[model samples]
Target: MKTTSQSRMRMVPTITNETIIALIGLYCLAVVMGYGRFLFTATLPDIMTQLTLSTTVAGWLASVNYIGYFIGALIAMFVPQRTTWQTLMLWTAMSVITTMMLAIPSLPIMLWYLVRLLAGIASGIAMILSSTLVIQSFSLERRALLSTLHYAGIGVGISASAILTWWLLSLDYHFDVIWLIAGLSSLPLLWLLLGIRPDNAADANPQPRSIHQTYINFKRSLYEAISGNGKAISLLSTSYVLAGFGYITSTTFLPVMATNQLADTYAGLQIWLVVGVSIIIFNPVWGILAKRIGEINTLIGLTLLQALGMFSPLWFAGALGLYANAIIVGMTFAGMVSMTLNIIKNMNPVYSNLLIGLATLAYALGQFIGPLVTVALAGDNDNFDAGLLAAGIGLLMGLGLLLWFRQLPQKSV
Candidate 1:
């Protein structure tokens, strides 16, 4: 047996090969699981038509995932930090994949809600844990790079789901067929993750001093983060809620709205596909820009772009509007998700995890509220004009709140 002195020497380094593998694994899972969460949105039209779902029911189906997600955000804290990332991802992905496969649009609303809730919980756990896994596994220096890559997966997943949906719809395949294909993709990923293990989940960055140490370095870090954004987080929460309300309702109904009162609707899925691909390029650009221009200003630009994209439905009737909206919305939406994290990080590095959880909550809340609000306005005909008007109102409200966000005076560099 090794001596106590020898054991101490072996535990010195902060990062290892296991850390790198975990990063890549997290990145891949981000794509796979994201596709799982979002495929429903991508295939909403088919789901409604085939399952004979009402607008409210369909919106709830999509929003239910967020409800599960909201619950998962709280549940995540209870999970042992020392748990294996592989097992965590595996279990989470399985949860998403299983209910997703079992989902029958023809089923009663109650059963449908249950599946969405379960999926939300699973995907929520996996995504939150994945983000946590990357942060915990790497040193501070590489965290930003990893974050950029992380949201990039959302881009990839969006593109894949769009293209896949388009391909199936074009081939005249049934909507259920698409779900089967999407769910089966997870099986191979699960097999690949069989041997992978995660690093220690304990507070690796704990201050080097004793438990009794007052204001330890780690605690100080938390203080600075909380201090910087304590009030602002509340503001951030409000901004995100409004933004989520407007953006989710508008974006969720994008393809549908674009097709509304228009005769040309041939390539909506393809247009959405292009938006996904654009994010692969745009997310990193926004990241670098956020680091330079600061998060507040960059976020303003991000929201503005989304606002512009939202206007495409009204820009011109027919396919022209959709084509324009898809391109603009896709690009900005990509940045919004990635940049939100950057914004939270710049405000407070120590509470990044907590903030992430909070942001997730805010976003989920936005989803829950957005659909209900939109459906109410849409009336019985499924016209989203009221929702769109409310969306504008929400965006303006978010912009006003953002002006109050305290930060480094909108940096130029």
Candidate 2:
């Protein structure tokens, strides 16, 4: 209804309302995904009993989500150019909500598997796309603050789920209720987000990369990360895979690992909560440091620290050792989740999501394989010293990849 010049003037952000709304939407999606994910993990024993499942079957069922995640990220290329970030977020919220409502103890195993995989894929695309939007929406100076807060969503969601689980489990309530509650909570968030759309994606009309190009870039990145193809292509891909294994081992297996090291009866939810709280506190600190020193150096130093934290408790068993390991490992590890995308953004401004999708595939593979491998390594003792050691190797591999990336020409990354 307005003149063209007037419409142009209105497009300028005077109060930054749109960006703030988009970030809120991001935080909301994190809550849904984080809660859904941890609730299942923390309540696995009960789920196994109710569903009459074996360990391998359960693992496959759980990991199906990661498979869906990879497929969804890969398919992002086919999404229409007119796709709005809001639409993706809305779909994610809806998928989680519906899946939870329909999820039941008597549901068929294959059906359960399908839902989990689809949910994982939806959540993966939503998370990655939300992150890209957050980065592009803000100025450089405000980025650290926004990024730290955005990353904190997982921690916050985990914390919320932890508290809810504590109350529910203490009262002997079923986990299905928790799932229903998680899904319901997200509905309002989506409703609140109905009017918001990302301005960042509005200006950028990047052509989607072909699947072939994705593989080529990923192969090149992987080759460089591992073989040091001497292009200094950002970190080696194999090493990144290993490091991802190490990081996931810490988050996914650390509670069980702690039980072994210290011989204490720790609840998985409680352990996850402590880890999440620690991450919430430290992510901002890391972001500030990254802003000052640089994301690359911060990544290098943190990876080393993460490696040490992985095996520390096993090396010196005690309450203090376990607690220290939890704080340190949780504090440093998710940077992998956040940083890889940031690094890809730095490396190829053009093919950022494709690179992110490729990197996420490596990460998903690491997570899928890492926990199972750790379980195998634990063997008779159910002691994860062997797993911890393997994690160290993975961390070293990831560090090597990061270092290799840094040495490459700035243009290469």
The number of the candidate with the highest lDDT is 1
TM per candidate: 0.80, 0.81
**TM-score of model 2 relative to the true fold?**
0.81
Q: Which consecutive 10 residues in model 2 have the weakest lDDT in total? A: 225-234
Cα lDDT tens digits for candidate 1, 25-139: 5445444444656777678777777777888888877788778877776555344345536436655666646535644545666876777787777766666666665555555
Clashes of 1: 1
Instruction: Give the per-residue lDDT digits (tens) of candidate 2, residues 1-413.
Output: 33574465455543345456545745664554575455556555556656676656655765676677666666553343245464466556756664475346666777878777777677667666666655666777677667777777777776676666667767787667767776766665554444345445345455679879867866665444434233443354455677667866656555544444554343556676787788778877888888788888888888888888877866776666566677777688666566666766555545555556666666667766776887677665566678778887788778887787787776555
Q: Residue 366: error of model 1 in Å?
A: 0.9
